[model samples]
Target: MAPLEYLRPSDEGAAIALAEADGRACLLAGGTDVVGLLKDGVLAPSRLVDINALPIAGVEIRDGGLSIGALTRLSDVADHPAVRGRFPALAHAVLAAASPQLRNMATVGGSLLQRTRCGYFRDPVTPCNKRAPGTGCSAIDGEHRLHAILGGSDRCIAVHPSDPAVALLALDAVVRTRGSRKERAIPVDDLYLLPGSTPERETLLEHGELIVAVELPATSFAARSCYLKVRERASFEFALVSAAVALDVRGGVIRTARVALGGVAPRPWRARAAEAVLRGSRMTEATIAAAASAAVRDARPREQNAFKVELVRRVLTRVLATAGAGG
Candidate 1:
């Protein structure tokens, strides 16, 4: 571990200014992911800007929607009454992530911004485009069982490791942030960037921009949503494939549908094709199967991860059926 400057900013402005002044300064909220990156030699920042003092650590109901503070613990979000009642999929996704101890320490913002669990990216000795730009991606032809099958570029194939993000994408959540210039509201779909040529840049957030809160809009389908994660083990494991499905069904027919997938793409993949197929369709086995097929129509599965193509389809089919049944 390298010695770095520890900065405790009293206000949001101070924190933003400190981070803007030093390009390599990292914002520390719960220290769940950042600490591990630092210890693993993946991230060596010049300073650590602790933002725990910035009064942004609660879940509030505003404008008939939910506003979750960026610093709110994952456990709190998972256990919040309103979250469980209104956005059950989001609650389930958060609860399915990590472990109870990590949920208590991991912040909502940190979870959204957490790095990929790719073995090559975490190990400095291995060549990874995400960790070192222009370098070869080790997972492209190496141990890539956990890599992406949908949104992988030739340079990188790492999957985004956020369970809550998949649900947020399905719910059309918005992220509010304060940057050096001005405040901005980024939709969950636009928050993450695909691993195109620039695999190192994973998100659209600019340098020194701090996520303040995530706003989930009130929707009829959100309450009927479901998040399903298929992992190697029962608990404390990242998903090999996951699906978040929300449906607004009326008179046994789907009126609106939102489907998002995780652990099979560079970012939380919004399955708009699947949603289009489900709209105005009856919730039957045939409809679910068609939608599932549409979701993976354009998947570019590698040799090692070809199983994820079928796995994601099955997961999406299950989630869609569950959400449709509940609706």
Candidate 2:
């Protein structure tokens, strides 16, 4: 582990100031992800800025939508009555993450900022474009059982490793950001950048910008929402293929549909084309299959991850059926 100087600030201003002053300062929300990286020597920050006291934790029902604070723990989100009732799909996604202990410590902001789970990115000995700008991506032609199929560039093919991200994408969430000079809101889908030439840059946030909260816009589709995660093991494992779906059925016809996929993309893959196919149509196995088929039409899976395409179809179909049944 690298020698790191730690600082615990009294408020948000101090935290932000410290981050602005030190270019290499790493924010420790829960230390679940950052600590592990530091221990493994993949991330060697000179200073660690503890922002736990910056008042970024809470869950509020606002006039527009649900405003979940960045520091709000995953367990708190999963257990909140408002979240469980209003956004059950988001709750389910939280429930499907790590374990009780980790969830109790993991924060919403940290999860959104979590790095890829690719082995190459974590091990200093391996080559990963995400960790090093000019270094080659080891997963490109190596053991890639869990590489991305969507939003992957030749520079990198690592998958985003968060289940909550899929549900947030389907819910049309927006991220609120605060920096030294200004504040702004960025749509969740727009937050992550594709692995283009700058594969090392994951998010669109500028330097010294802190994620304040995430807004989930109101939608009637929330009434019929579900998140289905299929992993190698039943519990405490990352998804092999996961789907988040929400639909509005009117007079036995699909009025509106919201769909997104995880465990198969560098960013959450929104199934807009599939959603378009389901709109104003009657729910039938053939129609559902067609929509599901459209969702993975552009999937570009590498060698070992080809099986994920079929699993994605099956999982999404099940999610749609459940949402259609209003279960």
Candidate 3:
């Protein structure tokens, strides 16, 4: 790895100023993904701007909603008393992800900005359009069992690697970012970008934007939510198929529903079709199964990943059933 200048800014303004001046500057939060990529020559930045101090490390409840600072550690969020009682599903998902040590170092912002786990994208020598334009996606012809089955294009097939974000997205979380202008809020579902002509531009963030916090709105669905993840190992592994489901089931009918999927899409996927099918519908085995089927209706798998469609469907059904058990 090449030697780089490291900047530990005392504030977000200094961090943004450094990033704006240096085009090769990369923001460092947890260093879980960024450090490994730097060592492998995947990201050769000239400057490393650490934002761990930039007004980004707190959690509070304001106006009946929760505001989690961007730099808030994952372990803190997962273990907070408020989160444990109010958002038990999200807490469960966070504790299930990575390891105890990783959770201590990883931040909420870094997890949201996590890059794809696809081998081709990580290897700079490989033909990856995501790494470099017009290079072609090796995943199209190579081992793609863990690649995307939804919202993929000919140029890329990498799936988003986040378990907690999917659950937060399903709960209608809002992102607050500050850049050249004042801070603004964005819906979590809108933060991710579809793999189109520019696969490198992953999120809606501008070049020098600083994520301040993420605000989660109050929802009754949060109380009866659940996240189910399936992976090769029992722990310390990424999801092969995962589902986050929450519903407002009253009078034996689903008044409202929310569903988000991970490990099967290019982004933290919101199952709008499945949620639509569940709204005002009875919560039965057949009803849940049909909604689950609808969730993966647009899944297009490659040679090595056809089983993901069925796996995702079953997981979605399971998560919804688990959420609705005591409702």
Instruction: Give a tens-digit lDDT track for model 1, residues 1-327.
Output: 789999998899999999999988999999988999999999999999999999999999999999999999999999999999999999999999999999999999988998999999999888898999988999988999888888889999999999999999999999999997999999999999888899999998988899999999998788898899999998899999999999889999999999999999999999999999999999999999999999999998888889999998889877887787793
1-327: candidate 3 lDDT, tens digit per residue:
899999999988888888878888899999999998998889999999998877778789977778999999899999888777777667877887799999999988788888999998889899998888898999989889899999999899999998888888888889999886667799999999999888888999987788889887888787777788999998999999988888888888899899999999889999899998999999899888989999989888988999999998889878888887852
Native-referenced Cα lDDT, model 1? 0.92
Evaluated against the true structure, the overall lDDT of model 2 is: 0.88
For model 1, the superposed segments whose C-alpha errors exceed 4 Å read none
| TM-score to native of every candidate shown | 0.99, 0.98, 0.98
What lDDT does each candidate get?
0.92, 0.88, 0.87
Give the Å error, residue 109, model 2.
0.8
Give, for candidate 3, the lowest lDDT window spanning 10 residues: 318-327
Q: List the residue pairs that clash in candidate 1.
A: none
**Which scores greater on lDDT, model 1 or model 2?**
1
| Tens digits of per-residue lDDT for model 2, 199-297 | 999899876688989888888787588899999898999888899998889899999888999989888789888999999999899878989998999
Model 2 regions more than 4 Å off: none
Clashes of each: 0, 0, 0
